[model samples]
Target: MAKTIFITGASRGFGKLWAEALLQRGDKVVATARDLSTLDDLVNKYGDNILPLQLDVNDRAADFAAISKAKEHFGSIDVLINNAGYGLFGSIEETTEQEAREQMETNFFGLLWLSQAVLPVMREQGQGHIIQLSSVLGLVTLPVLGIYNASKFAVEGLSETLAAEVKGFGINVSLIEPNGFATDWAGASAAQTTAMPEYDAVRAAFQAGLTDDIFGVPEATTDAVLKLIDSENPPLRLFLGKYAQPWVKQTYEGRAAEWDSWSEIANAAHGK
Candidate 1:
């Protein structure tokens, strides 16, 4: 069956790749970007199968309106890909309060609002899929991306809860956690705070350690997403990229070890 897939941030990066791949596979795609001009290529290539809309995911009104338009045009939105977010790179101390708030607004609240907008339609239809584009950093943190990590952590928490809540409605929610990918995500799409003198060395070291091979191609991510879409029973969380599996595994193992080390005290506090 050809699904009517609504994707946010479809101008570039993983969002664009996903839209193009879906369109190529003959799916109906409602692709939204802040600037409609950015999606001209998609529209030109895919014709009526692609509906390019101008949207800022942070705008609640725009989100609702876009969802309405999609539902009107396609009759239903079978799938929604919440891929509209950017990375804000800086240490927590270096990132301003405004920057942190903005990051949360776009990455967390925007997704929340959009999901809310789509839920009603999905509920009425009785079957839909919501795919959230989170990051491996959601499971584990790293230096210089504290705020970005915080946003993704929130995404992970919310998506997990959402998955459980919506399953009864025949709505499936999946979180795609990809590690570093070869996309404008780290370049043009990223926002950086002015560097703090104290954090300069650590930032430099982090940048220096990044290698080309460390970043997988966008097609790999597209393939993973397609598989998730096709699965009769998709996972609650699907981690992409070569390092995602090991990194997430190690994080859980470390967490389990810490919990086990303190289980006696933790349990005692709860009982008494």
Candidate 2:
């Protein structure tokens, strides 16, 4: 069966790769980006199989409209991939309040709103898949990326709850946790920090370390995504790349330890 997939941020990076891979496999893709002009290559190559739409998931109305157009184009959307997001790098003290909000608006709330918009159609159809693009940082907080971590953490929480809630309704939700990929996610694509003298020390160290780790081979993650899409029952969480595995495991252990430390208080409060 040729599945129909609507992917946000399809102009570049993992999103574009996924769209191309899916189209190669005979699936229909509603490829979207804030500027459709950049998606000309995809449109020219795949033609009708790839419906390139201009969409900024941050705009609620535009998000809904894109979904609606995709549904109409393909008859129905079998998968919704919320891959629209950018990394905002800065320390808690250095990052502005507005920067933090903008991060959340696109990374967290945008996913939430798009999922909500697609729900009615999926519910009526009785089966659909919602794929969220989160990062290894979503599981663990790293210095100089507090805001990005926060957004991903919120995504993790949202996907977990949404998965359980929608499972009974025959809808599935999954999270794709990829570590640094060679996508244009770094360099020019990354959000620049509003440099602060107080954070100059860590900023220098952070940039150096991050630059080295940003060029991961994206093929590994793309393979993982193909396997997930083909599986009869995909795992709720899929970790990609060597860098992602350790950080995610560490986060799991730390979270477990924290919960155990507070178990007594939690049980008492619940009258256990």
Candidate 3:
């Protein structure tokens, strides 16, 4: 059976690729982008299977409105892929107040608004899935991507809590944590802060890690995404690339070790 999937940030990158894949497989898609013109190709190719809407996820009312439009058009929304977010490149010190606020606005609050809007509709239908686009950085810190990391970390917590809260209602929540992908995430989609003299070395080390071989192609993830959508028992979290699991494993191990080292202090603080 074909499903109705709503995806944000579908102008390009993984969002667009996934939208195309879904439509190709005969799924109805509500694709949203800030610039609707960029989605003309999808509109032309998929016709009624795809509905491209102009949306800036940061707007709470507009977010709800988009969800309403999609529900009215498609009858019921089966899934929502909250992929409307961008990277903010800057260390903690280099980041400006405006940049940090904007990052949270789009990445965190936007997802929140959409989730809220879809809940009543999904509750009425008695089944729906909410997929959040997080990152490996949500599991660990990376210099210069502090704001981006914070946004994803916030998403991680929000989605985890949402999953638990909505489980009994027959609504599902999932987080897609992808490592570096050959999308425009780090290119045209990214916003950068002014470089600081002290952070030059930090930036260099970060830049050095971003090599050609590290990124996975956007199209390679189509099969996994399709399976996830069609799943009877979907996971609360899904890692998209080869690097995500290994990298997150190491980060969690280190975190566990550090917590163990402080166990005595932690126990004492909790008041035995």
Candidate 4:
């Protein structure tokens, strides 16, 4: 069935790819970015099927207004893709308080506000899908991406709880956790703080070990996203890319080991 899909950060990266792919498949797309001019090609190619709008997800009023406009234009948004976020590349100490707040505002709070705005419409329609673009960093920590990791971790928690709370209303929520992908994510879309000399070696080593070169194809990501959207019983969390599986597995194993080792003490504290 052709559906109306609303996407954020649709100018480039995964969001752009998703919007294009959906449009190619006959879906109606309301693609938004901070600058609507960047979406000219989409409007030219897809014509009326694509609605390009200017939106700053950091602005709560704009978030609500965009959702309302999309609903009004397309009748009801069948799928909402919360992909309007950027990566903050810096260690926890190196990242400033303002930077951290901005990261949270865009990556976490923006998603929350947009979802809140669409919930009422979806509830009334009794069916909708909300896909959140999270990262493997949301499941595990990385050395230089501490602030970005924290923001995505918050998104994972929020999306999980929201999935449970809205399932009764026929609204499905899913988080897409992708490992390093060939997106502008690390290049143009990423923000870095002032480099510290002390962490130079660590940063160099991390960069040298990057798997992005081998496993960061955007087409594969688009395919995974389309599969999630088409699934009748979509998973609460869908990990994309080959590396995501093993990386998340190792993270969960480590967490389970730590919890098991402390289970006795943890249980005792409960007055048992």
Q: Using TM-score, give the best candidate's number.
A: 3
lDDT for position 258 in model 4: 100
Better of 1 and 2 by lDDT: 1
Cα RMSD, model 3:
0.8
Report lDDT per candidate.
0.93, 0.87, 0.93, 0.92
- Tens digits of per-residue lDDT, candidate 2, 47-115, equal 889998887788999888888888888889889999999988778887777898999999998999899
Q: Whose lDDT is greatest here?
A: 3
Which of candidates 2 and 4 reaches a greater TM-score? Answer: 4
User: TM-score for each prediction?
Assistant: 0.97, 0.92, 0.98, 0.97
Q: Candidate 1: lDDT of 255?
A: 96
Runs off by more than 4 Å, candidate 4: 211-214
Q: Cα lDDT of model 4 overall?
A: 0.92
What TM-score does prediction 4 earn?
Answer: 0.97
Report the C-alpha lDDT of model 1 over 1-272, residue by residue, as the tens digit. 89999999999888999999999999999999988998998888989999889998999998999999999999999999999999998888888989999999999999999999999999999999999999999999889999999999999999999999999999999999998998998899999998889998999988997988789988877787898998889888888889889988888999999999999999999976
Q: TM-score of model 3 relative to the true fold?
A: 0.98
Per-residue lDDT of candidate 3, residues 1-272 (tens digit): 99999999998988998999999989999999989998899888989899889999999999999999999998999999999999999889988999999999999999999999999999999999999999988888888999999999999999999999999999999899998999889999999999889989989999999888789988899899889899999999999999999999998999999999999999999875
The TM-score between candidate 1 and the true structure equals 0.97
Clashing pairs in 3: none
Per-residue lDDT tens digits for candidate 4, residues 137-202, read 999988999989999999999999999999999999999999888888889999998988888987
